[model samples]
Target chain A: MTHKRVLSLTLNGKNRQDLVPDNMLLVEYLREVTGNTGTKQGCDGGECGACTVLIDGEPHLSCITLAATVEGRKIETIESLAVNGRMSALQRAFHEKLGTQCGYCTPGMIMASEALLRTEKKPSKDTIRTALGGNICRCTGYVKIIEAVETAAEEVAS
Target chain B: MTEVLPEFRVVRPATAQEAAAAHRDNEGARYLAGGTDLIPNVRRGIGDPDLLIDLGGIADLKKIEVGANGARIGAGVTLAHLAKNAQIAAAYPAVITAAKSIAGPGHRAAGTVGGNVCLDTRCVFYNQSQWWRESNNFCLKYKGDTCHVAPKSTYCHAAYSGDLAPVLLVMGAQVEVTGPEGSRTIALPDLYGEDGQNYLALKRGEFVTAVLLPKDVLPTVYEKMRVRGAIDFPLAGVAVALRRDGDKIGDLKVAVTGTNSRPFIVEGIEELVGGPLSDEVLDKIGDLVQKQVSPMRTTLVAPFGRRRIAAALARRQASALFAG
Candidate 1:
């Protein structure tokens, strides 16, 4: 096997370094090595978005991402959605609107929504639904998730 | 869990030369890009190469520039970037629309245009997990001798699954590939072999670097039919690029996706040029397209349905692109 390489990353605003095999997926590295279990591995394939994370402020599927590729890159996992123990406005809205059911896909859904809101700030319901379309939610039918994003937009607006 | 899965060396090469050298150094090595296609195939235990040369760290492969002669899209440029690129949106709107229709936001953010073009030919039988393949006694693509899609046929019949390929082909794009020797550019249509298994003509250890669009070509239209509006590979996609001289069709290029082995260019539709694009002419052209395209049942949609949709979408896009 090829020797493992040290990958330095700025994860959720903290500088971290870990030795990762080239085969180690970013999602696995995040959950297993960094102990950031918030990045769930749903499909182990690119089909599911449960392992979504933000790389350079853009949402990406972590399951398909090689951990070695993110060296020196800024990564934002679901854990960073909160600041100083206070949930981000989107998280509060997700809870307030009861947006989650099984909670498996929330992290990815929230990350995708966060990316969308960071750009649009106020998106239509259809746009929110389209934005989160890649992250499948077998639970809750996603009505409340769209509602949660809309509610969060309103909260941020007010 | 009983047996140890084979673990191979992993190499992360930061530059083109390093990546090429790493690939040449190992016998069972494969370049890894966005992995929207490769990672899933590996997890499914299909063609699991021993060494994965991660090309994602190579910075030079991620540039997207619009020059005097159309656009140059780097292989590592993500689908999300292509979908949102202003130059692509304005100059090559068909490609932008196709890229936007690829997957949801997250996967799009990770799926690169190069990965999409080099997507493994997909068949329902071929895409299953190893255990599932063991149960079914694998097909012509990976294991057994017989074709799964067509038992009587001699070769694999996996569907061409990329959404952007047809659009780019219609735009008359050329792809550049780099390897140990050097880089070479070829028309995208010339990049695929006729057979599904040997679809790509890329050399071993060679990586697709970029795609170059023609300068000041005709406007294009892309129409795709799938089960869902988004996050679904095309059941059948038709891309038509045409130049209009007043009301006559001047130059026409039609490429169809999700059919057969490689995306086929409809060079057969040149008979109607210089003639009035009347309803009857369009109908004849669609009929010719239907006769030429040989879509099979491997696609998610019905084979006949895909053929008919291909004809209809071709007619629609032709008229849409050519009509003033």
Candidate 2:
């Protein structure tokens, strides 16, 4: 028997209440229940960081996290990174630097970078690499992705 | 495509005793921690537990207490906390290093020390998708009757690949466990068994609550050999804790993981006591590791190749620790 509960969480700065299954993963709830397809599931499970999201401002694998466990927590996905429909600094940086090639891993990679830039206004290249270490981009070979994050950090700092 | 999780009721327990009671009340109930390891296995149709007792609500399990008697790390403390905690970084460099080396940034943010310590044995044949396993006709660790890794043998050869177990084992840590019966403490080595299928020796309904470190911390180093620097489990991991007495080694302990069913301390380490930090002693340490670790065809890497790498890691870590 599947148990269901009304999960109340802050999603993308908006309070949301959804009757989700206890076993439902956060990624599933975001994409299916809330119609937020910004998060991607790259691997069969947690092998890839394509489903990364920020839970309370920390990058966590939403694919492995149950939706019910995150009750009342602030969840930020790639969908939440814009201000009044304008692309955030990190998003603009990715676009300008050509950080994405196929764009499959961009949402998660950008969200992971978003978390890092929030805390660290100016992070070293090594720090940026470590922050996005979980994120895998087969395209771009991470060169442009690193440059995008560096440009975003400089823009945010300035 | 995203894999669908099996249907199960999640029960949030506030305390360790309550969690144990919940597990006892529900048959085939599993304690859910960070879910980094368990969720993936569940998605792969490994063990289908009907109930999941969520331990995230237990605040006590998420504590780290450092006092005169050393530190007691609660089971639910996240790996990211361990990696960034100033106290842990200052007092236990090896622990922090191991925590940082686990998986990746997202994984470390969600994964916990207890979950890593109790991680299931992994094999190339066992950790695949359900369809993949079905096509291979299963293995000895799960539903299959025959051991695919050792086909003729009756035992499963899946190797334990947790990074923290070796570091903790080398530092002489103890684990505090709680179960349906009661609570007790045991040395870290006693927590594991040799059988790959049933490696963890915890009794039914019992789970580790906390790990207690000794008052006197030693200089230690952890070395891991894997295909990638991030998001890959170690092929062969080694941890060495040594105290230098002038130019000689004193009270040295070496533990190895990822090559056996159970992470274990290499025997005959006492023989190296008082020995100079020379190439001869380092070779002996490597030889001892190669002799003790029993690696099978559990991963893409060959068993002998993993054994050699494990020995090399042991020797390299021991030499580095001795030098410092």
Candidate 3:
């Protein structure tokens, strides 16, 4: 028997209540139910981090996470990073530093960076690399991505 | 290639015994931890379970208790916690090293100690999309008859690639398991079997509750050869725990993973107990690892290469620990 439950969580800083199936993945819940398509589904399931999101301020793969599992947690996606219709520091860095090429991995990368910068105000390049290790970007060879994260970290510190 | 997840009801049990009871009550039910591994395999049409016993709700399965008897790590404790916990890091640096090396940061955040400990074996012939498996007629580990890695052999050759087991094995870890029959604690190595297909020795409704570490601490190191620095499972991982008494080796325990059906301690190391650390001793260690590890064409890397890498890693870690 497939079970359906009303999932109440904070998404993009807004409290939401959605009727979702028990087996529905968080990626599916965000994209299909809540109309938040920012989290991309990459590498079939968990092999890729294109579906990265912040659940209670920690980076997690939404594709492998069940929607019901995060019933009352705060979930931040790519959609949550922007405020007042302006790009966040990380987004601005990525845009200015040419961190994205194909742009498929941008949302997940930015979200993972957002989680890292929340706890680590000024992370070293190696720290940034390790924190964002799960969020892979085939384009830009990660040189620009690391630079973008560094730039954002510098901006935040300044 | 995106595959839709098959429909299944979720059972959120608050305790390990209750979780096991749920599995007993519901036919075709499987225990779900972090779901980092099971979800992907389920998407690939691995199992057709009707229900998932979500153990995440069980508070008992998420605690970390450090006492005189060492640490009792809850099975549901996330890898991220294990990686960052100062007490665990101070007492068992190898544990932190191995935990940090698993998959990617996001996966570590969601992956649990129990989940990684109970990770399913992997093979090139298996772990593919349904259509890909169909084209190859699948392998013995999953749907088909023949073991592609060794066609003449009846047993599967799927390799166990989890990083934590080897390090924990050397630390003399034990696991607390609960089932329909009740709870019992067993040594970590006994939890695994020789056969890759049926690697875990767990009973039908059994699940691990917590991992028990001993109070004794030995200087240990873990290293692995992988295609990438991060997000890649170890091709051949090795862990070494050594106690140096003056110039002689006081005690030593060597364990290996990613080269066999189960992570195991490399036996016959007792002969080196009183011997000084030397080039000959390191060479013998390498030889023992090479002789014991049975790597097959389960991965993209060559069998011989994996075996050599396992031996090399074992020797390297052993030597490094001996030096320190």
Candidate 4:
């Protein structure tokens, strides 16, 4: 469709600009243009959360979202979680807790956990479960993932 | 991962009138809302539109105003916002109930109420990849002559599985539509058509601008039957709004979806208008609704199962509303 324009947005705290097609998905734009391959595309149909990203600090499915629709907005991906080769508390907790089996859903799980922790200083197990309900893990049964998030919450609080 | 979208041009208009004007200029133009449904339909080669009018950026279409009369929700209001609005939650919890029931938190963040109200009906035989559909010979909903779900049927039988429309209709909501012609408001139920092939009765280049929900002090509930709790379309769903007069029913509206070609306002609600919802009475009403619903083989659930669940779900929701 006709609205091919110069799409500009803040990506991971950096100003980025690109000419994108009207039908380009946000996930594809992030991976291809921005080179953030950490966001996996498990199901391009939006059934899976592997393509989840924080649009203005809100969890959104990038696979189904059009890049042109989110123009001039702040986007945070899994790549933004770590800084200067040092893992964030949640990432370290995931590593310490071994919250992955096939390692596909880790990025989405961590992103969701990051959002939850930012809003709720200390989220209960049920609150954590409800918040991460959108991000599915096919390999691990989410037991360790939940524990990892809980541990990260404690670590960040302390 | 591109789903192989058809080549189309996008137009982002700042106002509803501008959006409508864009549609007036371009032929075969479609309004792009959240793209949760339209984008996928495009990937499957459903309706080919050369120009798309993007309504996501229009600021005027995203307002949520609650006044003495009722609430006026901009069509562009995201489903996630609706689920989180505290005042709206207290007054119209069923709207949130229906909103949260759809897909997951991520999809809900991207999905919009207008998109759900105008969502395309779905059928297992129709919603597939282009190649997958090609092998099976396309159904009437897309590019074929006959509907595979009901081969002998004259009209398409795609199931209307959206959760919001039935709830909106039950709440006596009115919709404001801006189109190539002009802006006009109509009842929510009037927006639908009987045939799935031409489900929405929207005029060409017309898009829903906002939903006007009248003040409803009555108790309401929405119950949906989906395969998974997190992310799946409804197999069958029921929405009920009730006003009780002491021990008798004062006024009630029961609507159902995910059962037939279009989400329909249950007929024979007059029976429940004045009677008490006793066990025997509710049991009979449930059975009668199932019979009147006449579930078809267009959705994931079997016809018999959907037929049985439709009324039971409605009764359960009704009872819950009363109990609460």
Q: Candidate 3, residues B1-324: lDDT per residue as tens digits?
A: 578889999878888888988999988999999998899889889986899999989999889888888999999999998888888988888999999999998898889999999999998888888899989988898889999899999999899999999999999999999999999999999999878999999999999899999998688899999998888888899999999999999999899999999999998887988999899999888988999899899888998999999888878877787788
Clashes found in each candidate (C-alpha, N, C closer than 3 A):
1, 0, 0, 8
lDDT per residue for candidate 1 within B1-324, as digits (tens), equals 011123656676778888888888888888888777777777777777888887777778888889897788999898988888998788888888888888678778878888888877877788778888778888788877877788998788888778889888877789999888878999999888667787899988888989899877678888888887667778888888887888787878788888768887886677777776779878987988798777776766778998899999999988877765
- Chain A TM-score values for every predicted structure, listed in order: 0.96, 0.97, 0.96, 0.96
What docking grade applies to model 3?
high
- Against the native chain B, each candidate's TM-score is 0.94, 0.98, 0.98, 0.96
**Model 4 CA lDDT for position B322:** 60
In candidate 4, position A153 carries an lDDT of 95
* lDDT by residue (tens digit), candidate 1, A40-65: 88877767688889999998988877
Supply candidate 4's per-residue lDDT for A155.
97
True contacts kept of each: 0.63, 0.83, 0.83, 0.63
Error of model 1, residue A25, in angstroms = 1.9
DockQ of 2: 0.77
lDDT of 4 by residue, A1-158 (tens): 34577999999999889988887889889999779999988877777788889998988888878888888999999999887889999999999998877889989888888888998999999889877888889985699999999999999999
User: For every model shown, what is its TM-score relative to the native structure?
Assistant: 0.95, 0.98, 0.98, 0.96
Candidate 4's DockQ is 0.62
TM-score of 4: 0.96
> Cα RMSDs of all predictions?
2.2, 1.1, 1.1, 1.8
Give the DockQ-based CAPRI class for model 1: medium
